[model samples]
Target: MREFVVQQNQSHSVLITGSTSGIGLAIAHCFARAGHHVMLHGLADNETADALRAAFAGYPGNQGFSSADIASEAGCAQLVADTREAIGNPSILINNAGIQHTAAAHEFPSDKWHQILSINLSASFFLCRELLPAMRAARWGRIINVASVHGLVASENKSAYCAAKHGLVGLTKVLALENADHNITANAICPGWVETPLIQPQIEHIAREQQIDLETARAELVGAKQPMARATSPDAIGELALYLCGDFAGTITGAALPVDGGWSAQ
Candidate 1:
């Protein structure tokens, strides 16, 4: 891991989407602490965005924040433009922005389906298209798509999410193959039952409905599919993302690495 840390003279600019909170925020911290100039993007309010940027003030790297929506080509373009204007051309892109909608395939709202695909899958493509040229020109790049366990396996009532994640995994592979000779590597990180703010309400609901403690509720939640019965910390995913950007991970492209507590192994 020490070899992966950015040296003072070799800092890279990173653009992490959906980085105001949760897993995305964790990834942003990882890069910033490692002395990489980081562009943090999320749909956070101005106050919250300011606070997040402030938290990184002590880190060695420069940090910038943006709230540009990335659900369309225009939004993606704006995000890339904002990132370049704020930080620099992003040599490292983490497509961590995502949304979720749960419903049976036939019952799923069409709008929700399109929304999920737009943010989860299409946005990554557009961002990569915009940033890859700079990376190629520099002869260094890392693209990490924050996919999900659903990318490798299916869950009930998550048709849209599964489809989008699976598509992202596929896109990662294609990007990896296409850029193999250009020093750009693309990979997907598929995490299951990550402890994020988005899942806090669900945990609380389970605790209340089952008359159990929060810890037990969390265990019950992950135990449903994960044999380890544990949720991966967002920091763990962030660490992996940081590593993937390092010299040691240069040959690990086109892989869907699972941090799922053995869920995908089943």
Candidate 2:
């Protein structure tokens, strides 16, 4: 595991969608550890939300949580407004909420397709649309989208996910260009085979369908595209996110960075 050192002096209010768990939660913690106020948004019960809030109590900056459905424009707008009221305008936004459905394109359910696109792609647009003004007014902001390797390569059964992630990458580029002079940077992080709750069901299904043990199924899945033969850690993604929001990365914008364990090399 690589060590992450938090820079001591700088801080910003950050809002991360789908931050109750998985990669989003990890990113939220990264910002909080850096002394930034973090507003977490996700679908979680009151108990889980409270636990997440309590987990951040040790951080220097304020921490807030919201259980808003971000799959629609109204929900995304309300989330931004609530975050601003709770912790001030977020100078950083991480669009990490996503849903996945797998099937042949012809066999994919229409409703599932729409749901995936709405949450994975449209929500990012809505959040960006609503939050960009604040960042522009302030003259400084960071927008990081958590895309997937599927954004760059085709997979057999992930049409909606791939399309949404690809769209997100494109959106990131446009935002970066439009905001270049405003001291705001937009980028996408493409990760491969990360161990998160989102991927657990797939892993189990692979095990059951292939009639293999869990470890074998895991190995086969990771080996199919990832040369590292392991899932990328959420913390690794979080650390990269933190780095991108720092002064050192001010000039790096509109880049689709692949932290994919060499999967893209293929």
The 0-to-1 C-alpha lDDT of every candidate, in the order given, reads 0.92, 0.89
Cα RMSD to the true fold for all candidates: 2.5, 4.1
Cα-based lDDT at residue 50, candidate 1: 79
lDDT of 1 by residue, 155-255 (tens): 99999999999999999999999999887899999999998888889899999999999999999988999999999999999999999987678799999
How many clashes does each candidate structure show, in the order listed? 0, 0
Candidate 2 per-residue C-alpha lDDT over 204-266 given as tens digits, one digit per residue, 9 for 90 to 100? 899999899988888888888889888988999999999999767888999999988899889
Candidate 1 error regions (>4 Å): 1-9
Q: TM-score winner among the candidates?
A: 1
- Candidate 1: TM-score? 0.96
Top-lDDT structure, candidate number: 1
Q: Name the runs in model 2 displaced over 4 angstroms.
A: 1-9, 204-213
TM-score of each candidate structure, all chains considered together: 0.96, 0.93
Query: Ten consecutive residues with minimal summed lDDT in candidate 1?
Result: 1-10
Query: For model 1, which pairs clash?
Result: none
lDDT of 1 at 263: 96
